[model samples]
Target: MGEDYNPEKEDVYLMYYDVNNLYGWAMAQYLPYGGFEWADAKDYLTLPEDSEYGYILEVDLEYPESLHDSHKDLPLCPSTPAHRARNSAKTPDHAEDQT
Candidate 1:
């Protein structure tokens, strides 16, 4: 594993190994935001080869906030008074004279 792993550019791998045998291993990649892309036991090695199994995990991840401002350009919902009130609060009133 390298420290240079960048979440934006690559996926992180989580490996499972049989501690007794040391040869038996399985791997999976972590999905963005949450969860993982798991590999089948047959894809790497059989789990029954050793009853004791352990995990070796490596992660490189990123979480970025949305750049779009939700408050900007919200369409007024005519059905809801609360929504109208919220939208009106955000609007600048020209009738109020600025000091």
Candidate 2:
């Protein structure tokens, strides 16, 4: 098939790349109500607390991909729920339960 390019796969990789770029400046926010948001680059860099949103988590591109594997046993992408849960669990509120 002459290197069948999958649009789905391409979209995923593009998304991962964008999120990583956002981390380069702004930060990823983990909301308490099971939602996520991103803070402005300036706000994130300055560590502002008046964002009127969730907590900001510093982004580390070197870290493992937030969504690595799939639930279907194949080396595919993860669902929205799975990714959200994984990221949410990384929050301080969730980690505090460990102690």
Candidate 3:
């Protein structure tokens, strides 16, 4: 029988493929500050790829093979502090300081 291949159910595992000998590395977007976000490779390679803008990956840090936190060396998603600041608007603290 031929090898079973299902794209939908299949998760493209990219690790140690020697694209650059960078172990557990992945492509992600880097925010202005200092953080990273992970993107699905399969989703990336889909028919309608998101190539409009140059979405880069965090190749410098190590990425875990599985989604689970098994390796400390591997890097995770960026923290939420930066995210909060982006969407939030605050008034001047001088008003509160006066009272």
Candidate 4:
């Protein structure tokens, strides 16, 4: 049987965009996950305050289990409670009806 794919085991990344240049770029890392603290992305704390420069995107790079297991020491970004609660409140069912 073929091997299973695990998204959580994949590498995570933070992509930065250049609005004026109309392009984007990503950092290079050997591990599947970016070697950064979770707090940097949680709570929108690390997000750029300015809109002109563009924004950051969190991406999960799906890779083979062998590769994922090789770099298990890499740090994984954390989804904070506050971020989860905020997203949960935005669900269509939870959204307020506009009449």
Give the per-residue Cα lDDT of candidate 4 at 10. Answer: 54
Q: Whole-model lDDT, candidate 1? A: 0.44
lDDT of 2 by residue, 1-99 (tens): 247776566234322222447664555654367566665565545555555654645553443555455322344533457678776656777679889
Which regions in candidate 1 have their CA more than 4 angstroms from the true location?
1-51, 67-99
Q: List the residue pairs that clash in candidate 2.
A: none
TM-score against native, each model: 0.15, 0.18, 0.18, 0.22
The lDDT values for all models are 0.44, 0.53, 0.53, 0.51
User: Residues 1-99, candidate 4, lDDT per residue (tens digit)?
Assistant: 236756667565665644563233223212233444343444555545443333346687666667655555553543457878876665565555641
Per-residue CA lDDT of candidate 3, range 6-97, in tens? 76573555565336734434435323554446666654445444444335554555555575545333446544577898767556785587
In model 3, pairs of residues that clash are 24-63, 27-57, 28-57
| CA deviation > 4 Å runs, candidate 3 | 1-44, 47-69, 80-99
The best candidate in terms of TM-score: 4
Measured over all alpha carbons after superposition, the RMSD of each candidate to the real structure, in angstroms, is 23.5, 14.2, 16.4, 18.7
Q: What number of clashing residue pairs does each candidate have, in the order they appear?
A: 0, 0, 3, 1
Residue 73, model 2, lDDT: 39
Error of 2 at 17 (Å): 42
Give candidate 3's TM-score: 0.18
